[model samples]
Target: MTKKQEYTGDYPEKTLYLPGPTEVREDVIEAMAEPMFGHRMDRMTDLYTTIVEDTKDFLDTDQEVIVLTASGTEFWEATTLNLVEDRMLVPTSGAFSERQANVAERLGKTVDRIEYDWGQAVKPDDIRDALEASDEGYDAVGMVMNETSTGVRNPVEEIGDLLGDYPDTYFVVDAISCLGGDYVDIEDHNIDCIFTSTQKAFAMPPGLAVCTVSDDAYEREVEKGDSSWYGGFRRTLDYYDRKGQTHSTPAIPIMLAYRKQMKHMLEEGHDARDERHREMAEYTRDWAREHFDLYPEGGYESQTVTCVENTRGIDVAETVETVSEEYDFVFSSGYGDIGEESFRIGHMGEHTVESVRELTDAIEDVAGL
Candidate 1:
């Protein structure tokens, strides 16, 4: 068992069970080891085009796709700048959803929101009422499909149905944590723009943000001349249409990993991947109910991550630290105000039900509840 490679000093790695930056396959990591190439080269075009088409196929959407060398947060500003000409009606269900509304406000756009409790889902009727009540009308409605903070999967499809009456208001969704793992029919749901980061359900490394844009969203960007320079929908998608490459220097290595991982995703097929996530979610929820309660409202739990209420009166921070120290594993504490009252177990990406069991077992051993 002698080592072939010399060991390094102070190199400790914890198994990530967080909502994002999930476990990645070794081959995907090695994909980044390929020789570097010029961004404008033909090889780069092949790499970028393959990933883009593969992403569309994986998502089962005909909408144009944009891959940027940034986190999912980039699209928050991009969507606001490009589409929200007057007001954006955001539904605040959790931290990430609130952040989306804040991004619009910071960008100097008028933002209205339908507020909900931390773990409640957004109501479609409430959205309809908000739009109906807005005298100035709304340019876009922002929502988060999977609220990473509270583990609530808001009713995106239901709200999309309501938005059909208001075609002027574009539907923008943040599917960052559940896009690849969960099933969301973007076109059928009437989504104008949806965005996700690779590290989440894509099971890839960070540094790449993938988005899909409908034709209406593209027209809105064209009409709004002062859109974001770096993340402009037309500026990025048009460059790809003409040259099959990004408008700026892209994250070539990460995209290389994206190309490899996306192939595995296609091979597994979308329906099967989504079913696997559902299985993991059900297993985790059943386990949670055995010892604690779910933080999100019943029948609206996220299929990618589960937020468990600390009904056992355990010290959440201490429990997380002890699990990491003893099991070399890590998960998330409840977000924002609920940090001390709950903890999160992320079952997205390649996490199987058995993998979830390992962490839950360790948690039981550490907390002794």
Candidate 2:
């Protein structure tokens, strides 16, 4: 047979295996394709406002929602700039979780941390003990809701519960990879600040970030002025309050994409989408154990994605390349430091059991073990 002809936007693309930019549903893809409008007009603000409202419900927060044009990293900075003062306590288990310490130091806040083994969830007991043991008494306890680098989902609610005794210490969570993929009840966790990116479970292309800030966190930022200027929470909150818009010109197209994607997630029903993720993860994990072992332990694996340890040691990168050529699906080989001996398989967005089996079959064939 001759090589198949290809044309952009003419044919539907194959599935994605990467952690983000996963397969988007047809309805969502078409939602962004709807008519464009002036960003300065009432239409844009209305769209933006809708997203903020939708995000609040999705995150289960009664907090103020902020949408930015940059990646989730920016929102991470916004949290420190917005409310964090003096010192913060972080429990780092993976690359991204450790990164919060770096950002906090750069933002001129003192940091304390209770370290956990890589690819392991930080236990609620340890967090509670740390909080009890610390004489300095941190103002905030920060953690990643899910650690993508090592395929671990931290117990955010459990950790947040540890902070209840210290009412002044707010709980900050990085829900970058877990926001829409699972349920996050802000009131239950007493989360003062939570941040996330658009590309993961939201099933949209990268470039926009979202966060919900509690009134306590907002007031804290007001008490500590000038932590940051541009893209800072204080100014953005003021802008939103004044005219119900971003402080600067927004990323109109990405916001448009978000509006469409959020609608799709809502239509899919929260319980159903979450159940799909759980079921897909279960299938993928069981299959992976038959051939290759998972990087993280049972009960701690990320539901939206899985990291396969390079136990086969059979040129994981080359196997990915071959599978991509024949199967038209691709995912990265783990994240930093762990990339050499591991690979990730994402099941977020529209990825299903059939898609996972397709990729798994390709892997078993290519690896020949």
Candidate 3:
């Protein structure tokens, strides 16, 4: 029989510089310790409504918001199930975007892809060509706003605008790693559904997924008539309209943290947050270019995470381990196929340029750059 490890309440505290599960504020952490409340209670109403409305205000959109106790990946499935009745189009540039296409196919929907290299951006022209080439009308089009794997930020807004030509096709975007920090104009882009989790740029602990749904997407699900039970827009939104809470039991503690953290987001303001992220991206890219090369194509790099190509050919995993062990700083190695060729630094959440420099400085010391 295998022996169980002993329980220890203590763990080392390391500053996170990874794409997701970024550093959450201490106050936000404490907010999770609030007294428990029943999902049907009035307190639950206050908690749910405040977070939902605050998210809309933060995103500056009138579209309905759904907050569920799941990762941002939930929406990949939800969006596919809710909107795509048969055929959908996906433009794959990196790992996450490919997974979005895979989700649709796994759900038994026909998915057509306009494939691009991992580090490349999804071109609007390519998406336009794909849509025009399709003989059967697509029920939806999906793509990632930020490809976390390669630090590539695709022009989802431009793609969303292109999707405007096909009003019958719902446009779904996975903005998981950049939504709160990147500040997309959801309504203006004509996006049918866009989603993110609190773990990324929201600067909160992981547990919740949030998304905004256009009326068209919701009605389309109604027309399809076989929507998901837990993630259905009609079920959750209608429940909120009638009772001001989630249809199923929710993670109340995380919602408390969300309420607290959302206030911080609002005070930062969407535009200000966007500017902060831009500044971090600029700084990180400059640093990467100085010491290494960038992975993504120029002019389309992500604002939240920067993937630095290992131009100097240093041992990435070794440096990451040394940084964690010696400096107590945690960044990420490149994801998937590019793991050894690149490294990534997440500069979103509450991280400033000055804070990001600390990690770079540590890297320079350990990697002897």
149 Cα displacement, candidate 1 (Å): 0.7
Q: Which residues of candidate 2, in runs, are more than 4 Å off?
A: 1-14, 33-36
Tens digits of lDDT, candidate 2, 1-369: 899877567643557888886777676666666676776789877988888888776665678888888899986677777667788888888899999878988888998888887888888888788878888887788889888888887778877766777888888899888778877678777888888888888888788888887888878777777556766667888888877778777878778778887877777877788888898889988887887888876688888878888877878778888888777778778798777678889888777788888888888888897
Each model's TM-score, in the order given?
0.97, 0.92, 0.98
Q: Between 2 and 3, whose TM-score is larger?
A: 3
Ranking by TM-score: 3, 1, 2
**Backbone clashes, each candidate:** 0, 0, 0
TM-score of 2: 0.92
Clashes of 1: 0
Candidate 2 local Cα displacement, residue 49, angstroms: 1.3
Q: Please list all clashing residue pairs in model 3, or write none if there are none.
A: none
Tell me how far the alpha carbon of residue 202 in candidate 1 is from the true structure, in angstroms, after superposition.
Answer: 0.6
Q: Write the per-residue lDDT of candidate 3 for residues 1-369, one digit (tens) a residue.
A: 989999797878999999988999999999999777899999899999999999999999999999999999999999999999999999898888989999899999999998999899999998888889888879998999999999999898898888899999999999999998898888888998999999999999899999999999999999999988889999999999999999889999999999999999999999999999999999999999999999999999999999999999999999999999999999999998899899999999999999999999999999998
Ranking by lDDT: 3, 1, 2
Candidate 1 — what's its lDDT? 0.94
Every model: Cα RMSD to truth = 4.3, 4.3, 1.2
Give the top-scoring candidate (TM-score): 3
Residue 241 lDDT (model 3): 97
- At residue 40, candidate 1 shows an lDDT of 93
Model 1: how far is 135 from its true place, Å?
1.4
